[model samples]
Target: MIESWVINDDSPVPVSSAGVVEALRSRIDSGQLETWLTSSSGRLLAFVTNAERAMVVLLEGEGGPGEHAVDPGAAGSSDGFVLSNGQGDEYPDEDTVPIREAFRLVEHIVGTGSWPADARWVVDR
Candidate 1:
């Protein structure tokens, strides 16, 4: 797993549901998370906080949503958990870099204002 920290507040002020959805869809389709896939059977798990301050974790794999209703504190201070299968490696530990990278991408594409100040990404094995 890899993760990094990104601080951006460029454009796209006050992220909306549509914006969040679009960001997620784009990231998924952009081949950005391919390196993080756990395996051929592995998947990407995205946990996000909604505009209503409700938390939802959506698995980008086959089985569909596994959990819901997770509180992520304030609305704009949104933080997310991204699970990336480590696949088979000499290392087996959780990394939070990917989370940072994902946040950076979102922040860049979304402009900035919509980006949360406390937004962080964490990757787990």
Candidate 2:
């Protein structure tokens, strides 16, 4: 597992739910996250189960119904996080960084309002 002090110091970035859902859908369809995030401007947020079998990403699209809700149709691995834009899609963990690490990175990016291609991860608190 990876932990970073930055994650603790940073708060989640608010984003548009529609945009985040669409981006995740693309990730599922193309089996890539980084490529999809290229145009996303870092407005996305993700949550993963400890088992890493399931996760949910949200767009801080304020005051919208189901902004954080996933459509029933767009789903991921039964052993992986499920996301469907009401369209068929899946995840490729081969390119998926650790979920918590991704979470921290995002928190830092959003909190600082700066995007870093790579971040330092550590195991020690």
**Which is the leading candidate under TM-score?**
2
* Candidate 2 steric clashes: 9
lDDT string, candidate 1, 1-125, tens digits: 32221211223243443364455445445532322111122333332222212222323354644322222332234233222342321211112223334444344433432224554433222
lDDT of 2 by residue, 11-57 (tens): 34433322443433445456432221211332334443323333333
Instruction: Report the poorest 10 consecutive residues by lDDT, candidate 1.
Output: 88-97
User: Using Cα atoms with residue i matched to residue i, what is each candidate's TM-score against the true structure?
Assistant: 0.23, 0.31
- Error at 98, model 2, angstroms: 1.0
The lDDT for every candidate, in the order shown, is 0.32, 0.35
- Whole-model lDDT, model 2: 0.35
